[model samples]
Target: MNQLPEDPCMQEIQRLRADYEAKRARSNLDSAGDRRCIRLADIPGTISGDILRLKQNLPDSVDHGDHEIIGDKVRPILNPPPPPELDDDSEELDTILASLPIVDVDSSKRFVKKGKYKSEIRNLLECEG
Candidate 1:
């Protein structure tokens, strides 16, 4: 009697079958309703308003105090301040200075008298050596 040997096509079918089974198992493990959506709806609109008010009142570097929920349980939440705005005049100056290269003006202009000054300096250095 002859038996069928495992081939590339059979391997591919087995891989697909395993993937389908894994997906089915995951679907079974998932909750009936997504908790994230439910949690978002449960959060009070007043809390969002408080966050906006806190942001408007404080500078970027400033730290807002922890939020405390009073009642049955005490839950603390931290809120950070918004980023500060850059001043227009200082920002413009920074941009302009960033574009320029540093150079020594006196050294560059010291040899302005034709090519004579450069040649003289070279000769003086040669004699000294």
Candidate 2:
């Protein structure tokens, strides 16, 4: 999950979220205080006109790129590379097994039943001698 995408553009987009979050944090820090707020009622006429003009200048929403182009662009996303053969932080099985502490069990040691549990015996028929 920590690895970047193959496409540089995607990598850039992925970074944008974190970058924007950080910038937002810094902006908040810089503007900390009630004094920094711009009240809508307090905004003078000229700045408000400029804001209106900017809003008017914005183009109407239009259909994006052609479907074919869109499909092509999303193909990589739709079909991603197979997951890594092994995770980056994962140790090799051999090394992991080697690192594990060995527990030696004595072959001669045998478990004996005790307590309330006991083996059941079947009655055998007695033969006339």
Candidate 3:
């Protein structure tokens, strides 16, 4: 026996199927050229007016020539050449120097003895006196 759909899910499926069939029919009709075609009579006069307005809005003179000079005769007074490229040996030397391990030195060993400062301060005081 055929039973009627009672659930919301079945109702939604039926609605989607109807919409799909309607779209397919419209597409087929459009492809068959049965739908209304766009004719010159349908175009408004405002389109021609817009084209004339765009042409009038453009600049009168457009300077599109090359501004840069080439060759030996047109030598640049202040322009400088690019820096020379470093050779492979120089690059390797730089990498080797950069990778070297650094040595930490003790500054306390370089400091003058306390007795030496005491004698210098005494001599300065004596000289002032």
Candidate 4:
């Protein structure tokens, strides 16, 4: 049986889809190139070889031990001797803190007191009666 001809609209849609896909692929590659990170796989063989050669040429006298660069090891903190002036400074600070008024949160006034409003309402009702 003879195949039906593709609709012109469908053909145009397919063409546009193909063009979009091609553009998307190109943009992905372009964005990948824009990234700051350089993958080891992407590095040129000659450049890697040069790096290896440089590492090999480094003198043994220059300790290239990874352990030499001490990592985050747990150690007891050496407490520094307390300064003689520290006691005086702390006493002054304590006096200043004590001088500041201690605010009583319970004594603080609210914008609208419930008891005051209720009394006013009762007074109004008594006057109306």
Identify the leading candidate in terms of TM-score. 2
- Mind giving the per-residue lDDT tens digits that candidate 4 earns over 6-72? 7676567668666766656543222332212211111233433322223212123212211111122
Q: What is every candidate's alpha-carbon RMSD to the true fold?
A: 26.1, 27.8, 34.0, 28.1
**Which parts of model 4 are misplaced by more than 4 Å?**
1-5, 29-129
TM-score of each: 0.20, 0.21, 0.20, 0.20
Tens-digit per-residue lDDT, 1-129, candidate 1: 222336666567667666766655544223333221111112334533333323112122213233333222224344424435665432224433343455454432233432223445456457757
Q: Candidate 3: which stretches are off by over 4 Å?
A: 1-4, 29-129
Q: Which sequence of candidate numbers ranks them by TM-score, best first?
A: 2, 3, 4, 1
Per-residue lDDT over 5-105 for candidate 2, one digit per residue giving the tens place of the 0 to 100 score:
57676667667766766655544223323322221112334433332223211111112211111211211133334444664553335533443356564
Per-residue error at 113 for model 4, in Å? 60
Instruction: Pick the winner on TM-score between candidates 1 and 3.
Output: 3
TM-score of 1: 0.20
Native-referenced Cα lDDT, model 3: 0.36
Better of 1 and 2 by lDDT: 1
The C-alpha stretches of model 1 lying farther than 4 A from their native spots are 1-5, 28-129
> How much does candidate 2 score in TM-score?
0.21
